[model samples]
Target: MDIQTLRLFTHLAKGLHFGRTSRACNISPSALTRTIQRLEAELGEQLFFRDNRSVSLTQAGEYFRAYAEDVLQRREQLQLQFASNRELKGSVSLYCSVTAAYSVLPDIFQRFRRGYPQVHLKLQTGDAAAALPRLQNRETDIVIAALPEKLPGRIIFLELTETPLVFIAPTDYPGTVCHSTNSEQEIDWLQTPFIMPDTGLSRRRVDQWFAEKKITPHIYAEVAGNEAIIAMVSLGCGIGVVPLLVLDKSPVRKQIKILACSPPLVPFSIAVCTIDKKIRSPQVQAFWNIATSIENAYKKGPTPHMKNGVSKN
Candidate 1:
């Protein structure tokens, strides 16, 4: 089958939505249907089983998908092998949090664009926690997110910046425990309503902190994103924990105060994550090079006067 058809099939396999795949591939639904039909005719098997509500790969489809992926990879390698060094072209699918999209992506994109003008960059922003799973599933080419303490296998991490995880509470909060001047006084953490993330590396870290301190948190609310937790904290809902980087960029920065924990929380190591095999594609490698090349810039922190989504000093 043609490479374009294989590409469409791969997208379809991941999304399991025909309309989405068609739109993403920039093709008419009817045309996509025809292409799949042609492939099925050649292979003598249906690639997908679809009904009104859902779409799924057939057993044959799953097998075909593996073959298609291999063929596509080989095709890319062949193209890269023959193509002139001056030009690089292909799409790079990137996943990152909304925070990362605004904060870190602009600089990465600027460098990437200059290096590979012909490459198509597709960036999708969501929960920072979900980035790794999407990368593992091959749904995205790369992810920009906070790295876990124990690294996962078969992935490469390019460290970007380290930011402390800070505890925050509303400035007007009436909780005397956080405001106490007596360091010897014990705070009743069980009575203090706490806001935290439902999942993600931040949540894991917060849980670890509580465990190490031998305190069971009175979890007032388990929220989704750090931005949401910050908002809740700003509204006097409860105390929350989040990366200092996020707090610096938070719109409600003036609403909250950073609380002093007896022992400081560990800083988060933010990085660009990608699977080892996918980077073999020249387009992915091109972006990877750009991201790594700017490591020093990120380590030095955002420049003064709002340069490239990072805040000024």
Candidate 2:
């Protein structure tokens, strides 16, 4: 099979969703199906088992994923070796949260673009909660996200920087129970209305805090993104939890105040994560090297918490 068809199969194997794979590959659904069918016929094995509701890789398909990845990595490496010394040309797809895009990407992009002008950089932004899933699904080549307390075994991370997970409340409007205070007793966390994250590392951390404190949150809303939580908190809807870097870059930074809890939440490690196999590609390695190099320079400068598309404060 041709390399392009191999890529399609690989995406299908990872995604298990025809529609998502089609969109990501920039092909029509019919064409994607045809490509997969052609691949299956060539191999005399069905790559995917499809039903009305779900799609999954067959055993043969699982084995081929490793083969496809290896082949693709070699192809890219060959191209890189033969290409001119002056320029590198290829595409790198990246996924990150909106806040990370604004706060950490500027430095990386500035340096990357200057060195590899011909590279086509495709950036996709969304909630931090989706970062790991998208990377694991092979939907993106790289992801900027917070490292969970128990990181998955399949992923490897180049830790960029760290930010504190702070409690925020509205400064202009005071609530009966939620207010700006350093003491745990001064603010009734259990009784206070909270704008909580619906999913993500932040949500898990929050849950841990609540469990340890033996306090149940009076959740006002289950927000999907940190930005949304910040917005709700600014409206005086309730107190919320967010990374300090997010709060610092927020347009409504002046409207909210950071609270001090009795037991400070563990800081978040902002990082660029990728599967172990993907790093074999020359393009991935090049970018990873560039990203890791930024940490030292980042530390010597103004904010020690920011680097490698990650921030902590």
Highest lDDT model number: 2
Write model 1 residue lDDT over 1-313, tens digit each, in one string.
7888899999889778878777657899999999999999999999899989999999999999999989998987787896556577778999998888888888889888887888999988878788887776567888987877666677887777878999888886655234224444555677678898999888888889899988898889899888899999988888889999888888999988887786888888787888887778888888877776674444635642211222111
lDDT for residue 80 in candidate 2, whole number 0-100: 64
- Candidate 2 TM-score, true structure as reference: 0.86
lDDT of 2 by residue, 1-313 (tens): 8998988887888778999989878999999999888888989998788998999988998998889988887887777676646466778899999989988777888878887788888999989999988887788888988888676657878777778899999997775355336654577666689898998898888999989988888888999999999998998889999999899989999999998785988888888888777776556777787787664432322665434322121
lDDT of 2: 0.82
In model 2, residue pairs whose N, Cα or C atoms come closer than 3 Å (at least 3 residues apart or on different chains), thus clashing, are: 162-312, 163-312, 163-313
TM-score of each: 0.78, 0.86
Evaluated at residue 10, the lDDT of candidate 1 is 91
> Lowest-lDDT window of 10 residues in candidate 1?
304-313
Question: Which residue pairs come into collision in candidate 1?
Answer: none
For all candidates in order, the CA lDDT equals 0.81, 0.82
